[model samples]
Target: MFKPLIKKIAIRIKFLRSLSVNHWRYLFRNLNLKELNIILVSLGLAATAGLFLSVYDYWALRTPAPAEGGSYAEGLVGEPRYLNPVLASANEVDRDLTTLIFSGLVKHDESGRIIPDLAERYEIKGNGKTYEFTLRSGLSWPDKTPFTPDDVIFTINLIKDPKFQSPLRNSWQGVKVEKIDNRRLAMKLPVEYEPFLENAAVGILPQHLWANIQPQNFLLTQLNLKPVGLGQYQLAKITKNASGSVRSMEFSPNPRYHEKANIARLTLRFYDNQESVLGAYKRREIDGFSLSSPLEKEELARSRSVKFYDIKLPRYFAVFFNQTASESLKETEVRRALAHAVDRASIIEEILKGEGEIQNGPFSFNLLDIGDPETIYEFNVEKARNILEKDDWKIGDDGLRQKKIKGKNIKLEFVLTTTDWPELTRVAASVQKNWEDIGVKVNLDIVPVNAVQTQTIRPRQYEALLFGEVLGLNPDPFSFWHSTQRKDPGLNLALYNNKKADGLLESARQESNLPTRIKEYGQFQEILMKEIPAVFLYSPNYTYAVSKKVKGVAVTAINTPSQRFENINKWHIATKRVKK
Candidate 1:
């Protein structure tokens, strides 16, 4: 049997080797239908198996990677005034531009954690009073100029100088900077402030470019618009209108940057308002833009080309009652009644379009990891009325509550001042109606966005101010709630003064241990809630709208809107396949 099989196989091999195209075709033509069908099925199966192997090999070995070419255009609401980091604190546009064009010794990552940027590493010394930083090796500016510790020293000195009038001056008041060597420097604070790292995130200016400029001429210099620094991107061009107003600015990736960005070009277009920015986005003139108000969300979401990223920010908007501006608000029960009467959930739903979280205290629960107080001022109209009645506050003939204190008749009426922005105005109206529902008269004082700070906040002219406070990543409540920060230029909007609260804030600032600091903040919040200095409302989400073409935006939480670009270098508009 083996001999017969071998002889058959040999004969078949010889016959196949001798066969040609015409012979095979003739042979197939003579075969039966069943044999022909079997041959066709075998060929089809072999081809399918080959294709499956090819695809499996491809997918198993390749991955998608960010490619280094593409352009991105963003629409901003304001024109760039001063691109210098020291003076950019006042203008959002300036802050956004400076963030890309400048680099600091240290920077915050997408998670709001402090990371080294220009500095290679840092250490705390002198019992946490001194922070010593070592600069990264071989760092250079866009113009190929070497960067050193002197640049950091110069930037801090400018911020400390009163003539510069930098908004950052207050933070660096008691800090002293010393250059230890060409690549190392140290900053010594008056006290061991745990939040000093946040302050160190300020952008560093090129001393060689700014040293010759006088303080008076600082705002007029051309360098403000065309800056040179050690950031990921550098200014490439600026477009202006006939009126000499900047209409658009373009930036190119800095080759000298530590890590090159994937996007080759970045363009920012300026508009007078959010409407114009939205219009430009709808017209496809810009690839991405941020929303200033939640009202535009529905309209913008209708577009299929864009996506919305709702980022949680460490901020809160509240109604701060000035005890000195109104006599009725001086009483703790009166303040508690006002806080209880106002419906925070309704305001967030109607005014914010359900885009915000109802805040109960000054601190953010998500950011600080602290539990809410057991007794929150829940929305209860009857309860608010009962509290006022118990405190000797009676409803007068005008349908408003009044109380006689120290032989003086004080009506429970006060003005609620806020910016004329549509959202804030609506919030103020809703709050006013809520208070009025509980027999408390509330007057709405809507002022322009520019005048609200200088005219209303600085002078403490309003009895109650509806404003927002943006806290840093560390959430230091000292500046917003401390007694020392009550005067002009101070952020203590309620003019709140409590010795125990002040001690808690001061101690919290100096405490580096996370658990201890959190405990101190919890105590401070309890005191604030008991005193009722401010009626905490809600924390709104920072909505960033971008085209679906852009990818790699992983930031979920940010201290400020500008910090959304913390990982900008990783964002890309172009992609390529590479080995996994």
Candidate 2:
């Protein structure tokens, strides 16, 4: 049996060898050099075609998928002084950390809409005077302590306390926050204020940890340096230099965070000023830096790896006419002429380096676009001159505009007061030149910001105040344009008082429905345009330089610099490829 099995195996092996030799011999005998060359060329072409197809297929089949891990280093201008949410407002570096390490009940999204952050949902009740928020389930602080209504109450009460001296005290002055239950909270306002919801966007502190600290020791406590909250990131490590100044702050994704942070680690390095910040970026020590100085734009342009994002801030700079003080500006035709005389495009190009948007009205949110189309003003010198000439204003021999009305000669002249910021100074000078070209005598009074605010603005002494106003995330015109606020403390620099305008502003402030509020604001904007109370100029853009490595950074109408971090959890430094 063993012999027969061996013979069978040998016979099979011999048959396979003879078949291979016969096949090779047949191919060699049947083929010629010309045929062989054709075959070789066909084989080469087929191999090359296959290689190309595979290369194309590899790239075509891949899709960018967000990877879970990477670190991002950013340079900040100032050192972290107070990481506590209550006191972060005083320091930008502190605010930067607090924005990442603390979660607010409500937050302003990238589009400037107020959305629930820690709160699962919120409802406006009682004529928009009350806001009730329900905390999301499973919410916990960085220390794994349960986040409840008590934490929200603790934060609001601490801000309300006069001794705490929080910068956010003014925002929550007349608002009362009450605990509804362990997972629910209610904030009641004394008056109907739709923008009151914005105040609740402040980050909440853990009641369990902060309950023991006295109000006097709030800023002095060690916890301010190592705060624990329900934010996207938690403090992992703090590295300091020899002088005890914080060299860098390293943060890791919080396990208890409601949303997952794509960036595994975020490191913020403190610098003395913007110069140092830019230097670190040039050295490749940092990947991102916020725009602080105009000169930084040029430096950012030089770096090929850096990308500049033009984020339009919620602030608008304009020439606010004090019609009560300036007799020439009292005439509606003269104010209209002045509005059309100055070129906003030129101002944006020369002064802002083309880093601004032409502001058509007080409401500067591009997303809102609430202003009426008929209210849009254009720079037309001929139209402005026609408006002025129709009102019996004539060009004097002194090359200045003069008018004779009511047996009195009124020259088209007024001193424009503004702060001595480089941009403001240039803008004022440009305005002066434009008005002078239209045969109107113009003067500029540039003063220190503090002096202008205390002496000129507070007293309403300036003929025209060239200033900027931040309308907040939600553009509330009640504080800036309401007739009630036209006095010394009022922001109504134009002293504009119209009953219809006042009603629209009040209704818009009370209207919780977004579309109705927008319609009301649009009507109010029409009145402002018809009245020409303030010459709306341009809104400056918040320019930011970020490296190409950082992804998913999208900024919209940012009321404050800290709000840029609202979508910080979405920013990722690493990525992978997967199926679509």
Candidate 3:
């Protein structure tokens, strides 16, 4: 059967091969119009199918990729003062510019996980007390100077130096740095600190350029505006107003960067306030900007071209009770009464416009997984009144709770001090009303933003203070709750003194085990809930707005506002198709 079929196929192929061009034309001419039309239609359909298949194959093989071109401009509410990382800690604009213009040994990724940026790799030794970093080989600064261990040492020393007056001085106080080789260095901490890696993430300064600058003249140096670093971008030009204030800055891609930025240029335009920034964005003067207040989101949502990113930050706001200033706050019952009186949900809904999460403890919800909803102080006016009444505090004719001790009558009235930020003012008003409903008279002391720290916070002048504190990604409660931090220059605004909580904070910082640290923080939070040192209100979500023209912004969480640029090098404003 196989031989017969093979013979038939050979005969048919030979017959077709024997047909000349004239024979084929004669056969086509002999066909009727219907057959000719059918043949033409079949050929046309086959050609169309072939074309479709070819197009589909090409489409399937190609992929959209970020192209190495385009520019991005962002609007910021303030001007950049110090592009140096050591001094940039206090200003958001400075920090934002520093993050893009400098490289660090390590950096937090989009997920808020620490990853190597300048260092090729790092080793945690000496039971977490020592961190050894090995810089990437062949890395050079914008000035063509080789990046070495000396730069890391110089940067760390500048942070530790008293003359520099770096806000980060406190964190580097007990740390010691040693240069091992050309590209390697080791940092020794006074104790085993699990968050030591976070400190390593500070941007390293180029030693060769900065070593000769006097500490007194460091801030006045032109290098602050024109810096040299191994980062994704470098300062190209700066436009200043008539008063010499920086109006806008332009940055180009750094040729010496470890990872090249897809976007060729980055521009930052400064404004006097958030309103001005938003107006600039609306006028198409900027491609992106960060929201100062969540309430602004509603107004920007009307634009179809704008995309919003609700980024979670490790920050929370609270009302800290200063028992030293107000004798009545010394009573735990009184503190608890005030805590239970304020409706946190209402505050989040009304003031934050539901852009916040109810925070029950000192830690942010995104930073710690130790939150227990049952332990939260739910708002209850009756409970607040009952607690005051049971504590021998009776409502007087003036509707203020009064308590008599040693023949002296004390009224349940205290001043609540807060910065005059619009959000805080609304929160303070809500809290004041909540307390007043429970026969507790609250006097709101709205202080200006510039004067709050010097006149109110540092002096510990307020009886109760409404404030926000950024815990950062590491979320260490030591500075905010430790007994040693109750004084000026310390963050313990509550002036809370608790030996047990202090020990737990210390232990938590030293504890390397995640589970153990969580347990320690949980216990510390329990103590805080019982003691009622502060009433935690909410953690507001940072709203970052970007034009839809840009892409590849994958940030979900940030330790600071600057960290929103964690994956910025990957962002692109132009795209191209490439074969897979």
Candidate 4:
């Protein structure tokens, strides 16, 4: 029956073709010359219309769409020692790989908002002290083990364990995790902490695989070199050089991954230094690389094929005044005068090469309105001098200002301590020159990096400390500002203490609602501006260089170098043409 139907259709097609040919022949043979010419022109016009329609139809069918199945080679300036999430916080190379290999209960988006990852949804309860998280249904690790409350409780408990020595120990201290059921968990904090959600973004570890490992041997475990994760990518291959250093690592998409990653494979190549990294990129040995050091104008000009992206980190550099250490720095007028004397704009432009944003206060993510642009101090030597003079500070014959307090002559001189990095030294020198121009003597005491942290900052020995604080996303200024943190090991380098500011900081930390947090933070900034304890300098941009071959990279905020890969699942190396 089907054969007869096919034969009938073929016969109809042949008959139609024959009729069309005979009609065309009859018209050509019998028509007059003028009529034939008219028919020829009409046929030509119809053919031209048909040609245009064909081209338009072809073009319409081909529209660009994201295509899969490509690999990427990224270069970094360090080797990975620990791929485990519990220990890779300070290692950029390790963090880069771990970010793609592990999934946290919560993860930061490109905009730095903390969103749920392994958890289906979460809620804050009971005065913001208790956090309830519900895990997504049917979640599994790369090895097909069911992801449950046990994994979440195990990770938190391990972090809180003193024997584990995990880098996340500090954040989880005083926080207790309770397993409600297979898919539910609750975390209770000693106090209301707003950054708790951000802390939850720490990658979760597989309980079954790690439970057998002892705490002392956790770092030495081979799993650090070959990790099992529940992220978009899983460890596939690792190659090492003769020197016993990891040369490269290749990652493939996880078969049990919840979502699809456009990138099929990602390979990372480790190098010794920035020069070697840049050389590899120039030679096309690698596709892209990320650097904390911003590129110089000449260096940026050299990379013609690479696309550069600038992401402003949440860190800022400032000269924190120790009021308790120096008698002169204790005066509010003197601190304000010194703050106004330094040219922050010039420091960023000349020393930072326009790669930093001038910071008005502690908040870097625009959590507060900068408050009255007129209040922002500008570089004015005369204004600074007049401020000192109005406060009865007299200029001495030595070109230094002096003030008489309690029957003692104290010169307007203080030692400024900072690290020995060339960039920081240049900034310190620039700031010193500006302060000295205003009759304020500045003694530059540059020390080694470790000495600056251990000797000067930790002990609070310097009169003024020049330092940078990396405030992670969902920044909580409590550790850096609250009066309780003014002692040794506390980040309140300025020794700042104010009842109103303290209350603001404490309340801000407890507020879980974003708008309320922003409001409270704005009030805290206002207090900082009024107090003028620390002179805020500039915020540096995290620069990344990538090959133009990759696309769909949208990095707006980066809390760490690893956060740059937050959108790796959306990045594609190839494309296809499909209908719009």
Candidate 5:
């Protein structure tokens, strides 16, 4: 039967060939047999290749390129100084880097509650002062080494060193971190700490690798820029300049990462300002960086192809008045007068341009657990002049506020300092003019943030300063206001001292109940309103723009906001072709 079928097919092919020879002459009278054969062979080869490629592609779809899902753009004002979490000098850039390259014992939930990360679970011992954390089984770093509590101990010891110059020195001042076993750890603090886990901002380092290297000396080492950690991304490649600065880095996902990350490769491309960075984003040069200035937000809003994410962060921007002065700002009336002089309302609308609401005080305005809207001090310049007159701060011959103190007519003229943060610069100009309107003269001295913190703020050399504080996950105000913080090394920028205010701060930290805590905080603000050490300003809104190609972005409080990226495994890029 098969032989007959083959003979039948041969007879039909011979008949078709004879017809095709005659037909080719009819269509192309001058064509040769060789030309006709070439056309048929070419057509047959093309059809066979098309069918083969389609089948090959069908199989190719079964195995996709490693979890690569999206693209994004990040803007920065300058290059990051350090990548080590313990030695990270610049935060705005380091926070993004840390979230990708490092892991901590615990992470902050969207609601600011502490949740386990590298640590499986923790128990409260010593009545809330001591916290014993146990590492999760199978926990491993990007390099596949098992994680243990000694890593935490190594981190704490490095910060506690007097000369290492860790930025977190104040937070871990009297705390003791010790490894109990291979998996268990204990943190002992001098007093009850309500936000004990908030210290998780200190990303755990590998004890075996970093312990022997002195942090004070390691900052200049080659390993500082190329450090390893237990986060989703590992430093695959780094390019440096002649001066030894990391110019760019390409990060690859860790194969042993606890969970798979959506991104296959994350490349950090740095630039000098938001303008250059935005240009890179428009050209698709970078994926996933921050928008540093207000102008960057405006540009992102105009670009229809890009997506902008604005999460209200715990970072608060405002001006502080120095009260330790024996001259112009000595009286409480003078401080109240200065507070009411500025127009933070207009500044927020014109300068901030997004979701930041006016702070009722130094707490979250939309927090379900705390923050009262009624406590915000209203802007009133009319009330400002009244306070000045009561303090004998009459308009002087030179038109600045002046008064007789200790037999000298001390004119209210002081220097204000700030980083080149654009928003702060504009507000400083506005505040300067506002004080001038009320007959108080001010001189503006804007400089690098490093200079301000180290030279100006630390020495109390400047009379006042215009800057912002990155609020921590916990709501306690003790670190900023307590007399203990008034030391030059502490966050006591304002140098405010009120025993009653200190007591209120401690009370807020101890009380876990919401109602009594709210009432106490409310009363505390009511008292601070009268005390007026620093003029609280409006909390402005900021947006972090991403390329529309990426997804899974939500709001986060500024302190640990990028903790949102812990769920990076869930995000995916659209499979559609990217639009220009």
Candidate 6:
């Protein structure tokens, strides 16, 4: 019987190699499932081997499976749309892989202070626009090319090129890049200079290998999917689908990383959607990932065999209404009325399933951290109606809102573009219902994650948009809610043009002294809170479920913008085996 079981296992192992890529995907995907099913079948066979199969109660079978590596096997959000850090946005999956593949001049600390990474020290000119940085010696790319100032210069040039559509243009556009020496690079900024010292947070790319790729179309370049990395991971194998298209991302530890690679290898398996993503996790098909569902959180938290984490992070998914739309939302009274109508409290409690806290003010969360939640506007249906009435938006015979605009009843309708974040989708539906309660029309359009960024939000093409954005801790209202950001390379999602908001934001940006900067940003927050340009929503917490064996788990306030694995090098598995 033992020999027969061994033969069966051997045949399965042999069959695994001959399988096509899709079957290979299925096997690796169900590795935990296959392994567990075999174990359970073996246990049942043993029970059958014993003659007394009394009542055959499945008590042990119903018991929870041991929380092991399988819980980690799911919800990784699939392979990144963009692998190159220079082209990537704030994608968690891409950023995690990029953290392995690239290193920046300065890295942020647990306290949000800028610390040295590739650069040992930096010097700023008196005006604060020109920054000169000196690199640390003895750094090498995975391909053994020497790290130099030329790479920095080339990267800066690449970002400045309009054809690259480089995502960093928003942050890097104001700067002129130049190599001071083989070991140094200097930059000239466009203005009084805020976010410069911090912009070192941008990952520096390896120009030696990527330079040959045409900047006009770098994102689609064959090299992007398998580029040489300067960070902690080196590409191991380029796996293709059955059709021979690229799919899985596999990398081994980079021998050239300045610090030791904590994990031996990193593999990100592809899944078409979140359902499959979660399924893989439930079956323990992958490791080291993020969670989206409330049930997943509850189950993972209770699993004593695995380490679970729920760190309160400072990321918010807010709705930005185009105030300039048809003069319906332009009325301060009507816009504020729409803002006041939505019951964020009930929406969060019901739709979000108690996953977040309502934002205190427009600029609080991780950026400013000052606002009275209670004093902030709450849902008051009567007040919302009164405000709308003052603006001549009256209740028609149909009980829906109508305006005698150009002698016609006009019902307000707007489109909202969003990524496929389900919580936001549900919240959007709820908000639409709430807005309908106030007699406004809302059309929700769920677009691809990158499509919303590339087409709608970045270009300011929608009447309204729903998305999550993290304001850096130090506060740069200039980049986000400011009027100047309406220009090209700005993050003014609302396309909001306000002289007062612009003045306040610029003042906040120009203030170099910490106290002065904080005071100005506080004032900016106050104005934004009053303006109600973008509906203040909840800041959702980031959840991490780790294995108990992993040690040194910690989190910072800005955990949502960056990965918990950003500092993963300092972490170690306590139960890790000593290799021979």
lDDT tens per residue, model 4, 368-475:
322333357777888988999999888889888999988999999999999886678888999899888888889999998646766888789899888888876667
> How does each model score on TM-score?
0.90, 0.77, 0.90, 0.83, 0.82, 0.79
Candidate 1 residue lDDT tens string, 1-580: 3456545555645565687999879879898999989867855754555565557557766888999989999999888898899999988888899889888888888778889999999999998999999999998776778999989999999999999889999999989999999999999999989989988888999899899999999889988877877788889999999999999999888887788999999999999888999999989999999987888898776788898998878888999989998889899999998889889989888878888899898877345576676558999999998999999899888888898989999999898899988888888999999899888888888999978878888888988999999877678878898999999778999999999999999999998888999999888988889989889998888899999999898888888888877578889999987878
Q: Please give the CA lDDT of all the candidate structures.
A: 0.87, 0.83, 0.88, 0.82, 0.70, 0.68
Off by over 4 Å in 2: 1-64, 77-82, 87-94, 125-130, 142-144, 189-196, 212-226, 235-248, 270-276, 292-299, 323-331, 382-413, 447-461, 472-474, 486-495, 576-580
Worst lDDT run of 10 residues, candidate 5, spans 571-580
Worst 10 residues of 6 by lDDT: 64-73
RMSD of each: 6.2, 8.9, 5.7, 6.6, 8.2, 14.8
Stretches off by above 4 angstroms in model 4 are: 1-59, 291-298, 324-327, 367-375, 391-398, 402-411, 420-422, 447-456, 459-461, 487-489, 512-516
**Candidate 2 residue lDDT tens string, 70-163:** 8889898768888888988767678888999898988878877888999999998888888999999997765677888988998988998888
Stretches of candidate 6 exceeding 4 Å from the true structure: 1-75, 90-92, 125-127, 220-222, 367-375, 412-420, 441-450, 487-489, 559-562, 574-580
Local distance difference test, candidate 5: 0.70
- Per-residue lDDT of model 5, residues 156-202, tens digit only: 88888867788787778889888889899889988876665778656
How far in Å is the alpha carbon of 555 misplaced in model 6? 3.0
Candidate 4: which pairs clash?
Answer: none
Cand. 2 TM to true fold: 0.77
lDDT of 6 by residue, 211-311 (tens): 78776667788666775666656767766788765566777666676777555556667776667765665676665456675656766666565655666
Give the lDDT of residue 187 in candidate 2.
Answer: 89
Residue 327 displacement in candidate 6 (angstroms):
3.4
Give the range where candidate 1 is weakest over 10 consecutive residues by summed lDDT: 1-10
**Candidate 1 segments exceeding 4 Å error:** 1-58, 365-367
